[model samples]
Target: MDLALTAAGASVRAAAALSPRWGAAVALPLFGHVAPPRPVRVDDEPTMWRARRGRLRIPGIDRRGTEVETYEWGSGGRTVVLAHGWDARASQFAPLVRELVAEGHRVVAFDAPAHGASVGRRTYLVDWLDIFSALQERFGSFEAVVGHSFGGLAALVGVAGGIGAQRVVTVAAPADADALLTQFQAGLGYSDAVSVRMRELFASRYFPGERDPFAWLSSVRRPIPAAVPLLIVHDRGDRLVPFAEAERIAAAHPGARILETSGLGHNRILAADVVLDAVLEHIAAPIAAPAAESSAQVADREVVAAA
Candidate 1:
């Protein structure tokens, strides 16, 4: 049981009983908060040792100096940019980074604010976009931009917003920003009144002066250009971000290739052998001949042969 979640649940319920506006105001910050950053795992060590570490100062919400940790592996090859999910660091991409480097592709990844070695307690969706833009300015054009979970949505938004990349891969990612609010409401067992107020607060605070902020950030609403090849890797049994979200993403992009897996759940899907193969194949393929003329769904064990 999560003591913090439980306490938050009680607090929000109490506040909502008083006033939903107050409840939403209280819950907004919790929605942005991440758990403690994960340490480098045993499997991540080998890749970690091979990386050339660096830092980029991405201004925080209040315009304070906040430095995000960056990592690079291999050089003098097609550069592939990687973006990690919320609460996850760049090192989470160690397996994918290793394979890309072995294929002679330069790999770049960054730990978003409030994650990994970065110094912060809370981060918003716009912060992820800012980091991606900063990396693109430094790296120029990317051969591919692969993102996981929240990072996946950011990658799509960034590409749509003009970060050049020939190919894009999204693993176990949500379809839009609204999903974040929905999940937060469900997790804290808040009421619809609170949910409505939270939406108002989120939009006003995160994306001020925008008529339709969620649509602006939605992959379904503003998909990557049809010219760019897309690969959607997801697990059918994922509990964090539902498989339905991946389906919505695939439905939005006609020619997107889908690698549907089971049992790997959310985060573990990142290191799955099959998922890596699909991502690599997508990256190596010619942009002219997308993945499929239409969305193609292949099961985990058969993805390699299908690809």
Candidate 2:
């Protein structure tokens, strides 16, 4: 049995090295082995059904004549916006929304284009940011923004670009687009060159006339206005996004707090009590005053320091 297991592992590694898609194939089974068991969707859950409901309409960022669907619960006071990970709908945050509503906070969540009830055949970062901006505008400034996985990265970009959230929390978030692309390349057994080609292909197919979709991250990490507090929660056991990405985000942003845990993995972190508690604490904390200088000034300093 031991020999067989070893041989199987070797075969998987060989497959990963041979084909880019094989990496995902190999990683999926490992993820199932380590990740916590939970349903990915919770919209139909009884607790989520009890919360108040509202609909939102917002224009797409890059696409013309396109609108996105948004859902809101609770009142406008002390609003919290929740963004779910890739391939997940707004209902995926049902558990968190129920708890937040019980605490007297309003919650707004949306189905990313092509996910849940939202319209579109494909989804991308710009679309996610547009939805975030629209929600911030409609619901008033968000007291807190909590996002999971890819959604977490989107939240950071949106908040950095003036989404009006007082506090930000990311669960198992990749620090930047480059990190995410690297992960994909490693997982898919693709060289850096192939990864670049894949990104070009994705952008061309997804955005058409766009120069590059991946370059958006360069603009995202600019010094955030000092008023917003950022919190990142990641599980060391996560197989999809490495925990080191969270550390990088903390290192990049001054005063960003990172809470690292074990056993939660990627999706399971959503329902992890400890992760949820950290998020609640961060949101409940008092807001910091906006920075005396502009974020661009701070970002320039960061660049110089790195150089």
Choose the strongest candidate by lDDT.
1
lDDT of 2 by residue, 1-307 (tens): 3464455456555665777456335533332121122343444567555645555555554456466566677774899989887767777777787778778888888777666666666556777788777776777788988988888888888877778888888888887777765664554443554454555655565557867655555323564556677787887778888877876676667667777777767777777667666778888888756556432332211100100
Off by over 4 Å in 1: 289-307
Model 1, 185-277: lDDT tens per residue?
888999999999999998888788988798878998998987887889888889999989998888788777888888888998888888888
The Cα error of candidate 1 at residue 4, in Å, is: 0.9
Best by TM-score: 1
TM-score of each: 0.93, 0.74
The parts of candidate 2 lying over 4 Å away from their true place are 1-44, 51-55, 58-62, 200-220, 290-307
